[model samples]
Target: MRFALSEDQRMLQDSLAKALVDVSPLDRVRRFAADPADTAADVWQALAEFGLPGIVVPEAYGGLGLSMLEAALASEALGAAVAPVAFLGSVLAPLALVRAGSEAQRAEWLPKLASGEVLAAAAIGEPIAGARDGAGLVAKAGKLTGRALFVPGGLAAGLIVAADAKGGLHLVRGDAPGLTRAVMPTIDDTRRLAELTFADTPAEPLTSNDALAALRDAGWVILAADTLGASQAMLDKAVAYAKERRQFGRVIGSFQAVKHLCAEMAAELEPARALVWYAAYAFDHAPEEASLVAAHAKAHLSEIGRFIARTSTEVHGGMGITDLLGLHFWFKRIGQNRQLLGGPEKVREIAARVQGLIGA
Candidate 1:
């Protein structure tokens, strides 16, 4: 029942944060927004160099063979900077694949994913939510044909993981025939979202419809972990601003209202951290409940994380929105997370359904 970072986890977390600060600083995020090639290659290499891309994979597959808790720790550190690239898709996408793929499939695909030789982007969601029949979404047969919006780093991805009409996972080569994609601008400058279209694209089934139903739920856990890191960054920014920005007579942080707000942000962060870790633990120790915990974590963290981000805008006054300051970066990150996998209401309903609160 106890949740805390082990000694090695803490060290690795610090190392991951420091490494990103060195190679993927805030300035890099801005520049990358203008030029997509600025730091991705280095960042991608750094992740591989640090054994990051392989954390959740088994050791035999050329990975660190660590658990989701370890991967979540590393992910949280990257989230602090709103780091470019979809670490989850590149890392966790394969985990889901290995869990459901055939022995031949696992032997080949996992090692490539672990060593960073293959990068996969999860293609889900649509901007309009309708280019096809209204369904839960699915990937079927040996072909996947659909459009997905907001694919993270999708422009550079070499593989595309998608869901077809049956809600099964289909792994399609990035260069497959009848496939095309476009990068779209997003509120989060550090992240890249692409619009992807597939027309009878060749695909390899990663998992069946029933199995995908579960992995889809687990996606919320990874998203929640990222949200927690973003909330922490916003909280840090608000505190630093409160201390340095002078008021009528003294620093605003000295005032009771500002202090209370900061304290509340801190309190909210605890629950976010606990829930994320709980979700990670479920992924590691109790796969049965990972989906439920993922829904709970996403629902709770999304609600509070948005509150923190919104309050930070007010705390920083008008400067919060301006490029002169970087608060908008984290604010936008929160916004992205809110709608990335699903909104708070959708996840809460999932949580409710899991507990049988309402009949399906």
Candidate 2:
């Protein structure tokens, strides 16, 4: 089977790239970053107008009813622009609801999510879990009592898809009586994170046995896609800067060192891009391969994105790290993506287990 994006997918990708560039350029990102609230209301509304918030939701729920590959493409555009919006959480929550929610739950929540009327944060990676793999959440008496750290867009979510220590998933209203949220300090201001504390919070349990694994894998794929997009942006920026910047009476692009740097970034990026797309495809078409491929995609892109981020900054020299150029936005975004949902070491270990290379 061909592993390339279809003509329609390509058009969607192009349109999204252009739309994001127009609405979320560097200056807009800078403004959002500097805003104490860190909200991107205008950009978020623009994306909603494009039906991006529900890219992965089923069509019956007023969504586009697209697949993971389409979601990956949109994510790549958002990452390239480094738009300050909670696209990731919005995408993943619906996936969980579709997989696990009761018919009633899906009917109630999916439409709101599709219309961008509400935001959903994922409460995975509780400290008690000791890993980012969405464990250590405890549910008792239909109530949740645990702390979930690094909740994506938690502070703004109207709903939260939280995990239980036993691998069960639950939908908890963000305004549950015992729920409290606080913004966590992060290296990447563009991706807002919040810490959530629960004390006997009421939660609606989901029944789908496959929900946890599928949701986790979906999250991994989106994260990988985001990094893949950011890496490409880094490569483009580096090449553009090299062609324009002068050193020793010659364009830096003419220098062997600069050429090699840009070439290496491109080399690292190309394979990762293909791998990310394949991971998205596998999630939709090959369930057996989804987890392993997601792990591989996330692990590979995390490191490669770091390299691109650093090399791109080097190509710009002193200006790369400065706010004037806002290259740090991409740099820090890659940095944060590397560690989310576990770093390379952690993801690789999981992949090894999936390959039966280690004991369960």
Candidate 3:
């Protein structure tokens, strides 16, 4: 069986990377991060023109009708650029609607989401419908009460797919009555998070019983892929810096210790790239294995991404921590990806439970 990406997938990755380089370079990301008010509107527009917002939406709904593998590829490119766009929600919201939404829901929202006319966010991180921060939503009589934390793209989303305490999915409009949103600050400013409070806010329930499982699997795969791209970028930056920086009249890259650090990072990360690909492929092809594989990918990449971030920074010496080279963008991106959804320990526990090695 072929385990490699098809030629078309490679082309897609290349094109997206090039577009991001032109539109969201490190300097542009820095400017966006410096100002909380800057929405990175032009960057998101470029992505919309490239069809990223609609990559997985059905072609009938004005999307490319691509698979999760393609969406994961897009995520990898976005991670490499560290672009300040609300992509996690853009992808997840459409996936949720596709999997569980009624005909009217899809007909009403998918087209607008695909065309970038409406922005959407997904607040499904709660595993058992409760957040680690003691925040969660309760659904009653077609309304939601309580709160959701760490909602990506919540501040600007026109629609939100929230999971309730019963593991049910519901859709909430951004302008719904009694709905309130507050931005949640994090170390990584490129991706904005928000806390959502719903006070008997009206909601529309999705019909599928299995949508939450599918959504979680896809989330893990995408987050793992994002970490993969960001890790590779940091490693590349470190290698480039090592080659140029001289110590004792010789390039630092020539030192045995530096060579080992670079080699170790490559050795560890290169194989993990295949892990992410397989997880994504499983999501689209082998539903039975998707959950376990995605959990492994997310957990493994979180650990590896952190290692790469630290080692890559170490390679840059003092400049790594400094803002001059802007290495912290990739660093912080990796760090944030590590904790999003579920961290390594939490994901590993899920994997173990899935395998029946532990009581669920």
The per-prediction tally of clashing pairs is: 7, 1, 0
Instruction: Output the lDDT of residue 302, model 2.
Output: 91
* Per-residue lDDT of candidate 3, residues 1-360 (tens digit): 887899999999999999999999999999999999998989988899999989999999999999999999999999999999878888888988988998999999999999888999988877532387778889999999988888888999999999997789999998999899998999897889999999999999998888988888888888889989999999999899999999999999999999999999999999999999999999989999999999999999999999999999999999999999998988888898888888888888888888999996
**What number of backbone clashes does candidate 1 have, counting pairs of residues 3 or more apart or in separate chains?**
7
Report, for every candidate in turn, its global Cα lDDT versus the true structure: 0.77, 0.87, 0.91
Q: After superposition, how far is residue 329 of candidate 2 from its true place, in Å?
A: 0.3
Candidate 2 per-residue lDDT, tens place, 1-360, comes to 776789999999999999998889888888888886857888888998999988988999999999999999999988999988877788789998988899999999999999888888887655312444442568999999877887778888999998887778899997899998888889998878888888899999999877777877888888899998888988998999999999899999999989999999998899898999999999999999999999999999998999899999999999998888888898898888888777889888888888999997
Model 2 alpha-carbon drift over 4 Å, by segment? 127-136
Better of 1 and 3 by TM-score: 3
Model 1, 119-217: lDDT tens per residue?
A: 878765431122334323344457766677777767877877776654567777879998887877777777888888787788888655465655555
In angstroms, give how far residue 2 of model 1 lies from its true place: 4.5
| TM-score for all models, in order of appearance | 0.93, 0.97, 0.98
Candidate order by lDDT, highest to lowest?
Answer: 3, 2, 1
lDDT against true structure, model 3: 0.91
Q: Residue 75 lDDT in model 1?
A: 73
Between which residue pairs do clashes occur in model 1? 138-163, 138-164, 138-165, 138-166, 138-167, 139-163, 139-164
